[model samples]
Target: MTEAQRQIFVFMIYALIMVNFSGSSHGGAVSSEEEADRITSLPGQPKVYFQQFSGYVTVNKAVGRALFYWLTESAHSPLSKPLVVWLNGGPGCSSVAYGASEEIGPFRINKTASGLYLNKFSWNTEANLLFLETPAGVGFSYSNRSSDLFDTGDRRTAKESLEFLIQWLDRFPRYKGREVYLTGESYAGHYVPQLANEIMAYNANSKHRIALKGIMVGNAVTDNYYDNLGTVTYWWSHAMISDKTYRQLINTCDFKRQKESDECESLYSYAMDQEFGNIDQYNIYAPPCNNSDGSTFTRRNMRLPHRSHRIFRQISGYDPCTEKYAETYYNRPDVQKALHANKTRIPYKWTACSEVLNRNWNDTDVSILPIYRKMIAGGLRVWVFSGDVDSVVPVTATRYSLAQLKLTTKIPWYPWYVKKQVGGWTEVYEGLTFATVRGAGHEVPLFKPRAALMLFKSFLRGQPLPKS
Candidate 1:
């Protein structure tokens, strides 16, 4: 691969890492309490929760990590209910961004300062819904020391997040025994599984275990090459990429030989290379607004200083809800703080909120490969779901990645209809059932909440889905 192509692939590597993307080991244990305290405190930082709209913040006394999350009690029925934790992509995206504000949270935001609005179809009503800003770096979670952003990568994040959950559930012990499900879209595909794996492993290994029922990933980024190739075909099928261009690119383009000829440019430039914005080439989901200011990666503060999900553009706009949750989040007094990304790194430009991660390449894949097979061998159910429209981690890529399974097709592939249309489909093979969300893009919850929720509900019950 050329230097540029290598960087493009690197982007994919990090996305995989970020998304439940796993990586090499990080030294364990949160810094000592005294060390956490001695980091020159930003004390009295209150967590914000939604309803009773709670997106409240809390510190894990055990780990000295700060976590921000939203919770809902709208479920009139809480009898042995399943507690679902939803995640947004970005490896660093806020679940609160799409999960709470747009997808299944209890409330939605209005852009024009109309205040919080109740979602007519919030998912929490069926089950207790929760959204969290994990890993101490993403979303409202922060540390007094700027260097706190440095400990990123898959392994550390996975452990820290599990620690966070254990700590959080410890704090809210009432729901510890509740059937728990992990759900997310885009990059979260990796996050949900990896996190689920950790929870499952911990429960299995620990003396005092926990209950983690199942996991669900939507339009996930579980694999890179297949997802990318899937993108080429999906775009071509929809005329986004013409047949001649597709043929020319496919015939010459090669992942193994990215350093070859002009075909390298086709995959590098054509595959990515947006005309504007400095989003990581591998991350196809929308990025935080590009600041008009001439700031370099670190200079550009990702804080909305306004709305996180700005509805400034209306191309086939699905919803306009910037105002409702903007203050609930981006407007949080803490988020408005200045960018402390890199003091000595590039100082003129901007990077996304999770930009600090851009500095290091976290290319470590998960170590749970054997565990997955082990789970199936033990009669455990492992279901992986996909969204068809995601370009970053396309459905095609997921299919290609899982082909490695070579498992038997226990339940044959079939169309899964929603709203009387091709709202994607499903397939059950071996011990895994892979499904697709039609018409939904990367953030399946925001684009297709009902279908996504239905998928989770079915998985939780370990039962076949209802005919639409």
Candidate 2:
């Protein structure tokens, strides 16, 4: 052959080799048509303008452990929007049940407790939302290895979650290299930071890295000692417990050590007995759910007799039994098939929170402040929000925990407005931001959807909370 012909042939061979290499780099070519994971229609879902996908990402192939995720694309310009992964912290909670169904997802459970309705203020209006059921044995995600089920903890959870994200991106290659945000509430204070740290480490070592840009955690549990102390203070300040009980609690309980003397336990119990009398500890201002007889209490007249009897009431059109509704909706055979869930037909039923897993959770970090400081220093946007009214992981706890960081104020604390009304208070620091959702409980979005959306949109835009 002539020199010109040989050169042309070599160019064609090189192009072919590059194509193969590109495909192999992404673990083989992934089809854009993810029909297998698409939701044709949920059982009673309202007509929607956006697409939804739900399925499992196998994190541990040998153990058959997988983390389940539900993704809702933005209502408009999904391709241009950033992706936010939302997690709910119980250390064992299902983000699908809490974060998706009740808080920020595109849909909410219907009042009848068996169907879904569109959440007018869903976060998907602003960005693509991804909700994950992590660490196996939570909600629809499961582990074939029983030991894996019982042996999960903070570090393992972060590792598995990171692995899931990498594989998930591979499955939905369109989202590869997209700007990603990690957001969660409660225990996720621990999960989000730990997972973000892991992602940062992975990005440093790998050729393909997740474009994690920011993290936001709301009503989070950041430190054990501060959280506990704040709880007692909140209870007393709210007049839920007696002053004597409060003083006894402070003096007797060694929150830092996680050890309580026998007398401390007695004082704690007494304080709780006064504080929880027929009240939902999660939301102090909300009314309690009534029994079938329309009575709010049991016949025995005991103070806080049965915890199960403490039903959640509707607060600002939010239903506490939304978890129960989601449980019913997801367990339907048709719903599972439509979402591509329960592929193995895991023998166990799905629940909002796994009692076993929560009980068995190991390695509870006393504080995640160090992780936060590291991430902030690394230039990742970090925002912490709190629902001022939530008794569980209240705003006071978050304030105390953040005080540990000793961050200087970049912007003086101010009230953030929504629709010409004060929605919440916000404070901007050198490396972190703190905000509160007025009148919101532990689940901020559930109680204050409009305010929550405002906060989320601000976070995504890297703008301060609305000042008007």
Best by TM-score: 2
Which residues of candidate 1, in runs, are more than 4 Å off?
A: 1-64, 243-266, 271-317, 320-329, 332-353, 358-361, 366-371, 378-380, 419-422
Cα TM-score per model:
0.70, 0.88
RMSD of 1: 13.8
**So what's the TM-score on candidate 1?**
0.70
What is the TM-score of candidate 2?
0.88
Local accuracy of candidate 2 as per-residue lDDT tens digits, 177-284? 789999999888889999999999999999998999999999898888888788778878888888888888888678776445777767766655655676656678
For candidate 1, lDDT tens digit of each residue in 1-468?
696566456545544543341222222222232122221211122221212223223344544456566566434444346778877655555676667767777555565433456665677667777776665666666554455576565666667668767765654545556777787776566677778778877887887566676676666655444554665666566544556667866676664331336644644355333331344212233333332484322222221111111111211115423423343445433333321122222222221236564233154343234545665674556777765655545677678767766789977777776667666778788777888877665556666777877776677778655556
Off by over 4 Å in 2: 1-33, 293-317
